[model samples]
Target chain A: MYGKGLRALTLATLVALTATFALVVFWAPNDADQGFIQKIFYVHVPVAIVTLVAYVVGGIFAFKQLRTDDRKWDVRSYVVIHIALIFNVVGLLTGAIWAKASWGHWWVWDEPTLVSFLIVFLLYATYQPLRFSIEDPERQARYASVFAVIAGAFVPLNFMAVRMASSLVHPRTFATAEGGLPGEMMFVFLVSLVAMSLLFWLLVKYEITQKNVTWQIRALRRRLLGDDAVAPIGRSAAPTIAPEAAKPLGQRPRVSYENSPEARSRGPEEIAT
Target chain B: MRSREPRPMRPTWVLLRKDLLLERRAPESVPAMVLFSITTFVLFHFGLGRDEVEGSLAAGVLLVTILFAAILGINRLFVSEQAEGGFDAVLLAPIDRTALFLSKAMALFLFLTLVELVAVPAFAILLLGPSPWDALGGLVVVLALVNGALALVGALVSALAIRTRSRDLIVPMIGLPLLVPALIAASRSCAPLLAEGGASWPAAKWLAVLALYDLVFGLLAYAVFDFLLED
Candidate 1:
């Protein structure tokens, strides 16, 4: 399952993302006003949008974990949050760099761009500590669900508060009545957004598969070492044959046989005879 | 061990009375809030170069200082509750949790408002002479809205503090950013009234935003208070 899906999705996302960037940088016209630096918008805006999308997905998984009490959803939510954090940091850094090039300053505290990034940073930073502080799995998931919902609610509120506080230091979508984006730019932007979303989904699937495989291996090892004769397939079965060479020093020797449980069920005297 | 009897409001009132009585005995929280307000007002006066025209700035400065000091007092109130194990007793009560939140919020609001009442007049006299009493109506509305918002946030933070490390530091870290919008709204609303004879519409709009924030968070905190207090 992981082999097929991971390869296909990763290849598809890479192709799409490369094409979108190529279109944005080479094919799209330079902004009438902001010139070459405005190209950063193609990356920054899409990343920002995807960051929000990732967070909402995380919150939905969190809610599902609460309702179903499923550990899968918890893993999904956890992985998605890490992905979201990556996108958030990238978006913030690129925005800062763009702001410096365009506005001649690295930071603008009053601007919505800076304020929204700060809020997202603070909200996601709380997730790790909140998770670590709790000892019980179910209780940790429950509290985290509540915190995720609260954080999700606050994100929009913080956005609105910053937007309402004052005029933007840089142009904002709301500043223009229709948020005038030329058709070509809008198309490329939409493609970039879709590509990022696909990439996020693929990464989440990869992490979940990795976790599932790791658990499977651990369970197999446990069964191989245990005395129980009930050999569960796919999980580790007790080594049917005890290898004389592999036995550790100072350990008891046991009868060695493979394929037939009958030979293993016999006494050591019968096997020696 | 159980007996059937009528349980009255006595427990909640007892809690409220205990809090008030403690305040009455110490007299420190309220006085400190008031003194903080005065000191801030004095600093503003000196910074504004003692110009009577600067009364508007004084109103904004005085109100913010009083609010910050009130937060200090609220943090102390919850810290004392944790220290004495009084919070557990309150949580064990049979009364509705909303009542507990409401009663505590009201008490803190009253205490903070009392400090504000003193601060307002002292601010007015020290900065600007007595003016039209009609503006007092607007002031009352702004104060009620801001104080309610503050108390609601304070209660939520207090609950968080009990469960987190560095209880003192975490409460303010979480609470202060949430308070910024309300502060901006209240200060803007009060500035025009204290400076000129009329209120600005923009200021009134900000006051409305403050009222909305108070209503939304107030309901949220009340609903979640029980979960927060659970063992």
Candidate 2:
């Protein structure tokens, strides 16, 4: 079920991303002030936007996890956050590169946006460890959901506070002497945004489907060859979806170990002996 | 239904009283935090190689010291509960689960205040270039606001980390970043008060930021705490 739309989504992401690159290179006008250097904005800003939005979406999934006590939602939240953290690294690296090209420095403390993102990056870097340290799977999911919710709320508020504290030493990305992004640049920016968002969604869906598939395979092996056929999951921070929960109840294997051919051949007496 | 149900505040007060009484009897967390704060001051004195620091430097040193000291207190906030089966005991009680969060945050707030009482004066004497008297009033307000931010974050982070294998490592890693906005606002507000010319009132904006931060985190911590308490 999780994989139902994954292929189409991935195809769409690839198409849109390719189109975005085309638009950025050929259509978007160079900034009057920064010239070719500002082109990085098309990639950097969209990734940053998608990263932040992914975090909030992860929080929403976490909220659902808490409300329903469903392990699947926890799995979804974990995947979303895990991917978003990767996007965060991409965003930071791209931002640093852009800063160095434009401002002659790899970093600038005066840019509130950059600084706030760095703080957010540092905060979320602990999420995996937080999940890993709790031995109980249920407790790990619950606590992580709580953390996601809190950190989600913290994002916008932190941005506001940091921005308010630091004045505009760094130029505003969208606004300029021209009174805002030009129509061409804005179009390219919107296209890039859609592409990045699609990519983020595709990754999340792909991960959830992969995890569900994993659990279902294990459940099948357990059903066919008996419980000992499957290895136990070791300590992990990632949430594990119960096999039955990942699929419709009707689709589950009808023959369990007790009712299998192996069990019939062995018989109760042979096992007892 | 049970014939008797305790009032909500009753549980909060009971827990608060228990923590306070425990601190009074043993006096562990507060003393350690105070000592840590004063020692940080001494280290800053030598590290900066300046007999005195004022303005933003003074604010940064003072707030950073108090912030780290508060982290020390945060690490210990849940030790007793975790070690002595207090969490299970509370789970068995009929009272609201948020009471645990409330009492613990209040306990930490008090501990931070106690540390500041000695540490702030000690800061003025040791490294602060400006006279302490002029800045005392404004400094108090700034510290009080800073303390609230620390307390709320401390309580939440402590609960989050307490059951983890590496509780100590997890606290500062998570807590410090969550706290940076508050630190920025507080230090900025305190800078003018610590300026060499004389102490003056902190800007209204930084105070507002601190207040907003406290309010946001306070509600966030309260709402999210019950999940942490699930058995």
Candidate 3:
């Protein structure tokens, strides 16, 4: 079920991303101020936006996990955050490239957007370690959700606080004091944003499907080959989908292997319960 | 037989009283925080190679010292609970889960305030170039708000880390990043008061930022805290 819409999402992401690149390269006009350097903005800002929104979305999923006590939601939340963290790294790197080209520095602390992203990144970077350190799977999921909720509320507030602390010396691309973005630039930016959002959605879908598939395979192995044939999952930072949630493959009628012909040769009481 | 249930806040008060009594008897977290703050001031004096600091430097040193000390206290806030199985006892009681959060936050707030009573004055004697009395009222207001933020974040982080392995490593790593905005607001607000020429009142905006941070996190920690208490 997780993979049902994944193909269409992947196609949409492919088309949108290709269109975004084509438009940015050939269609969008150069910025009057920064010229070619501002081109990086298309990739940087959109990725940043997606990363922040994805984090909040993860929080929403975490909230659902708590409300419903569903292991699947935890799996969804974890994947979303894990992918968003990758997107966050992309945003930071792109921002740095843009900064180096524009300001001649690899980083600029004066920019509240960049600085806020860094703080948010640092906070979330601990999520996995926090998850890994707890031994109980249920507690790990519960605690991770608690963390997600808190951190989700924090993202916007942290942005606001960082923005306030900075005296607005850094130039804002979207709403410059000069005025809002020009018409064509706005269009291009909007397109890029949509493309990035689609890509983020595609990645999340792919990751969730992968996790589900792996889990389903494991469940299938357990059901067909017997419990001894399957390995214990052991300690992990990733949230697990309960075998019950894995469905038909995992639900094949339990075979009493002990009653089978091979086991009959060995006798009933000889088998370990 | 019918039994009457206590008021919702009764458990909070009971837990608060217990924490206060424990601190009163042992005198552990507060004194340790106070000692750490003073020691950090000495280290800052030598590290910065400045006999006296003023303005932003003064604010930075003072707040950073207090923050690190607060982290030290946060690491221990839930230690007794973990060790003595206070969590199970609380879970068995017919009280709201948030009562434990409220009590723990309040206890941390009180401890932080007590540490400041000595630490802030010590900063004045040891490293502050300006007369703190000039901005005493404003400084108190700003520090109180900062303490509110720290206490809220500290209690939450402590609870989160309490059951984890290597909790000592976890508290600061998680707590510090979460606390940056509060520190930003606090240091900015206190910079004016700590200026060398003369102390002055903090800006309205910084105080507003601090208040907003407190409100948001306070509500957030409140809402999600019950989930953490679940077995």
Candidate 4:
């Protein structure tokens, strides 16, 4: 089911990304003030927006995972966070490149937006370590959800605090690319946002489908070569698929939570290592 | 195993009392916190090589000292619980499980207050430029709210790191970053009070931020705690 819309989403993303790249190089007007140096805005701003939105979306998925105690939602949440971290790195790199180009510094504390994003990046960087430290899948899922929820709420608060402090001290507005965007620029920016968001979704979908396929392959090996043939996974941060779900291609009962009662809940699949 | 869950605060009080009694009998966390504060004060003196610290510098020293000492308490907070199987006992108890969060937070708050009692005086004698008398009254009120927020955050971090193998390392890594907004608020509020001219009242906005943090995380932790304890 996760892979069902893959072809369409991938095609759309490819079209959008290509179009965005071409438009940035050709059609989008140059900034009157910052000039050619401002072109980085096309890549940086959209990636930043998508990353923040993806983190919040990850939190929402985590909330649903908690409410339903479903591993699928956790997987979705994990995938979102994983992808967002990658985008976050892109945002930081592009930001640094922009900063060095404009301000002559690789980093600047004067820009609250950039500083706040750094803090957010530092905070979310811990998500993986926290997940890896806990070996139990169920507790890991639950605790990780709690962290995701808390960190999600913390994001807006951190931005507000940093913004307030910076504005009070510097009294200088480091206008983001969106501020006072002209009609032509706004059109280009909106297109870039769409393109970046599509690319994000496509990558997430591809990752999930890839995970699903890996699971199915493992199921096949278990059936064809017997259980003893498959070596086990060691302690890991990745969400464990329910054994029934993982074993289906190998002929195990696929009594999923969708149809099962609450009492039918089972412990997480064996590590088998 | 929760059964006939009638008493909530009663278990909370009992647990608080138990932790207090234990801390009193052997004196594990609070004493070490006091000592750590005094030592860090000495370190700051040599480290910064400043005779009289004021304004943001003073605020930074005090906040860092308190934050680090609080980490000491937080690191040890769940030790008794984790080592003694207190979590198991709590789950077996018929009372509400939320009491655990409340009691742990309360215990942490009290320990923080005790640290502040000593650390404030030490900071005054050792490094403070403005007279302690100038802002003592207002600072306490601001700090009470700040302490409340830290207590909630400390407990959440404690619960988070307790079950992990690298709890000692994880606590500070997770906690210090999580405490950033609180740090921003507390240090910013304290800066004006510790400024060179004279100790003055803290701005109301920082206190509001602290209060909002407490309210938000207080509810967030309570809601998610049961899941953390679930088997």
Clashing pairs in 3: none
Per-residue alpha-carbon lDDT of candidate 3 for residues B1-231, written as tens digits (9 for 90 to 100) = 767865788899999999999999999999999999999999999999999999999999999999999999999999899999999999998888899999999999999999999999999999999898998999989999999999999999999999988789888988999999999999999999999899878899999999999998899899989988898
Q: Worst 10-residue stretch by lDDT in candidate 1 chain B?
A: B195-204
Please tell me what DockQ candidate 1 reaches: 0.17
Please give the clash total of every predicted structure, in order: 1, 0, 0, 0
Q: Global CA lDDT of candidate 4, please?
A: 0.84
In candidate 3, what are the lDDT values of residues A1-273, reduced to their tens digit? 447766778898899999999989898998887898788889999999999999999999999989977677888899999999999999999999988988899999888999999999999999999999998999999999999999998899899889988878787776776797888888989999999999988888778777767777787787889999989988888975452344443252335333457644642222210
**Can you tell me the CAPRI class of model 1?**
incorrect
Q: In lDDT terms, how accurate is model 2?
A: 0.87
Worst 10 residues of 3 chain A by lDDT: A264-273
By DockQ rank, best first, the candidates go 2, 3, 4, 1
Best by lDDT: 3
Worst 10 residues of 4 chain A by lDDT: A264-273
| Each prediction's TM-score versus the true structure | 0.75, 0.93, 0.93, 0.92
Error of 4 at B188 (Å): 1.1
Candidate 4 is scored at a TM of: 0.92
Stretches off by above 4 angstroms in model 1 are: A1-4, A53-82, A123-144, A168-179, A202-273, B1-18, B25-29, B39-60, B125-135, B196-202
Whole-model Cα lDDT per candidate?
Answer: 0.68, 0.87, 0.89, 0.84
lDDT of 1 by residue, B1-231 (tens): 888786566565766777788889878678888888888778877887764643456456766776777777767756657788866777786776566666677778878888988988877677764363646787888888889988887777666555555556655655666666677677777776665655433365677788887887787675556655556
Question: How do the residues B31-126 of candidate 4 rate in per-residue lDDT, one tens digit apiece?
Answer: 999999999999999999998899999999998899999999999999999999999999998878889999999999999999999999999999
lDDT of 4 by residue, A1-273 (tens): 437767888899999999998988899988776778788898988998898889889989889889988677787888899999999999999988888887788997877767878988998898889999998888888888888988888888888888777754431323554566677777888899999999999889887777766776877787889989988777888876642444453265455544765524543232110
